[model samples]
Target: MNTAVSQQPDAGVLLELDGIGISFGGLRAVDDLSFKIRRGEIVGLIGPNGAGKTTVFNMITGVYRPTDGRIRWHGRDITGLAPHRIAEAGIRRTFQTIRLFQDMTVLENVIAGQHLKMRQSWWQGLLNTPAQRREERELVEHAMEVLQKLDLADVAHEIATSLPYGAQRRVEMARTLVAKPELIILDEPAAGLNEQESAGLNDTIRAIRDAGITVILVEHDMSVVMNVTDNIVVINFGKKIAEGKPAEIRSNPLVIEAYLGQDDEEEDDPLLNAVHDQVNA
Candidate 1:
């Protein structure tokens, strides 16, 4: 059941997962999942609860190693690299639940994310060498620039957890951006956002892609997934079920069945109804 991407990745391809799978105990959490992300494209990975969406993100970011298959980035094999090495390789991610340094100021949190990119060694930092001092100054400047872009500059000095929920989410994104990632994996970013905030987040995602960073997101919000992503990959029980454009996915029987179930009465479910409205609108 190898579902790996068939052809060799072209120059535009930024990531490729070939027949990747992982298990816990005797249960296979993710089985033979594969997908490709092109440079500068926003790809949405969507599925029902327990579909192993976040598990895929875990594998890609090195939080967990796949028991089978390969992960390639820029045509280089990085299947089981350490998390720090993965980040160093230009991949960064956000969690479904915001993982921010609650006690740290918005600016400081972003600066923390830039630690890997900093050239200062432990000794240099301990001694506060001239180069270390210079790097610190540059890091602050870069963090501020990222905050400004995310519209969080005004709250740069505010504590991370003290901000409003939407602002807090933006802070997390700002932190990830400070890492200068080539591919950003956002796990359920729209989860707790209001309609207005979700819309704004959608715009922010597009802006990130426009800036030449590739994005792969796992989200349950159909509207955001439909509006923001250039392509959609659907999974069910850990295996890929459907992959296509928004319009195609909206009308896909497999996706519709997976989300809304096959029951005739469930066909009018709110999520499916909204999908229909969006497709028509």
Candidate 2:
């Protein structure tokens, strides 16, 4: 166990993944990956599927402990913290599948995220007393604030399962946001969206960053990833291929090669083409 100081070289870094690696049985899902995210920045993690992007997110959010390496948040080692402890430490995430409570009202789903911080006892709830009522009221208000931020207030009373896929995605984000995390990891946020929905998601992500939370976005849409992310870290076959600003990443040969090797028909974005031309100048 290497007990090094958790801070990154960047004075503003809020999260650092130092020498992180994880494996499943004999398969190396992620191998010796390291990166740092600055406070209030939006960073993209991109690669071919099975590049261990989701596994990285899972480890950071405490779904799995890394087979080796360190994870730090705010100068504290958090490598193997429990999921709820990670959440309490101000990190939260939404899954690739948009895991919303289907039977719950949208507001109820968001309030559930406050589970780690709830102070009332089950006995208090059963008694239906003033303190429990006050807690419930506060929880509802907090849930509503989250809904309003995501512009989902109109559907607050609706069943989460009844919403469109895009709306369901918003609810997942809302649930995460209601927890007030300093770092939010979104996995494939634009996966099922149409062009318009993807664009809307871009706007929402920017709004979230502007509200002062750092964002780590895992996405495959080059156009969206290239346009919205401040920086990108590209991985291939469970290894880091490159890390740089969006403009730099857009033209990186290794990144292009990784994407091309994975899918021959993958389209290159106009921004990437423009950046490539500039890099050659």
Candidate 3:
């Protein structure tokens, strides 16, 4: 409902959500939200549970159409495009739940993500034409290169699900990278990772931005969000509450109140206290 933080023009914004909103029956999951993600920056979308974070991702990826407003990719309106079409348009995402092909090898799973970019048709693939063979070779090489970038090439042939949980997370990232998207949306990427694993993941995310991909990171882990993100947009009850750099967000009274509530007991709670410690450190 607040348009104050809705728009801030940037010269090279890769993705723009202009007054986006969505509802399910009587509940408004996201209400007239707006934000812009500049190319090559890691922007964190953070909030308390049920804060419409994932709902925004769903709308951007076309998993759910916005009830109002437009989603633009490089200034082109792409609202309501099918999910596959969105992927083909150079927007890819990883889920909160790992979605790797359990039976497939790590390399195979990454290669599968390149389907939209593959030029060979089904018929050509069925016949195993020379061109198809060549393309397949190239695909393997490309997938391996992505795996190498993410430090997962050593386990390239292992069953995807057989790796350690952190490594498996890297596999999912490798899979998304193979698609060569302009924007990558990760939903709670550090969900199951321990502290050490989360630290490593933070490096991997920085690497992703260094690779020239803009990232919209939806995460609940305040430490990861605060440490890794270049900018943060905070929301609550389906509305934008705050948006700024990590330092500003860390000190914002609105953000502190949103997460800690207004009770004296809550002010001294572990979660809020940890947040204060991180922000001040």
Candidate 4:
């Protein structure tokens, strides 16, 4: 099932996934999905469990090459690039499960993100050369700047495992930003947050856009999507069912039926009801 969107002039497209299809054994996980992510836009990808949301993320970040497709970053073929190479090409991402160095302090976690940016060679870091020392000091300063920006400086010295769940999520986001990627893909960023915490995340996401980076997020919280996303793409049975603004997605019968069929009455998530009620309110 190929899905297509015509190119637009004003909102320049930053990422393009064309004819992307991936399968595991005999089952098709993602089928011929195509979409354009505009520069500085917040695009949400939503679907139920087993909808191939995370599989698409893996393909984009080089965790897996698509069975069939071409991925373009800034309009250049980037398919099958090594994960580190993709990171170097201005793309960074966070996982659904927080992947942080638990024993490492928050500051160290952020500093680790800059490993790619450090100019010093392995021998320099190993031998502690003056140039390496200076670069490490500079990386710390840059990491602190990121911590301050994310309001994580208060816990900068604490062990990452000591922070609350929401704070842990923030730290992961700070690490992603530390890489200074032009495009960021967030997988289920609001997964464990409460209502108020999710709302705060909405503000933080908007701040990222204001800072001139594009965000592609996969979230189950309809509230966050309605409140933050500039555009949305809905997938079910590993195929795109709808693509539009929050308002349009909510009103689309096919989208409603897709989720409603699985579990009616908002599917045991207040996030969905929050979106619907807010829309009616």
Candidate with top lDDT is 3
Q: Estimate each model's TM-score.
A: 0.91, 0.90, 0.92, 0.91
RMSD of each: 3.7, 3.5, 4.2, 3.9
Evaluated against the true structure, the overall lDDT of model 1 is 0.87
Model 1, runs deviating above 4 Å: 1-8, 262-281
On TM-score, the candidate that comes out on top is 3
Q: What is the C-alpha local distance difference test score of candidate 4?
A: 0.85
lDDT score of model 3? 0.88
Question: Which residue runs does candidate 4 get wrong by more than 4 Å?
Answer: 1-11, 263-266, 269-281
lDDT of 1 by residue, 1-281 (tens): 23233455677999998899999999888899888899889999988767899999999989999999899888778888889889999999999899898699999999998888888899999999999999999999999998988899999999999998989999999899999999999988987899999999998898888777899988867888888999999888899999999889988888877876645775665555665565467
- Candidate 2 stretches with Cα past 4 Å from truth are 1-10, 263-281
Better of 2 and 3 by TM-score: 3
Model 3 lDDT at residue 10:
63
For candidate 2, write residues 1-281 as lDDT tens digits.
44344553468989989899998999999999999999989999987767889999999999999988898887788888889888888999988887887689999999998887789999999999999999999999998998998999999999998998888889899898888889999998998888888888988899889888999999866667877899899888888999999878767889767665544343464333533444455
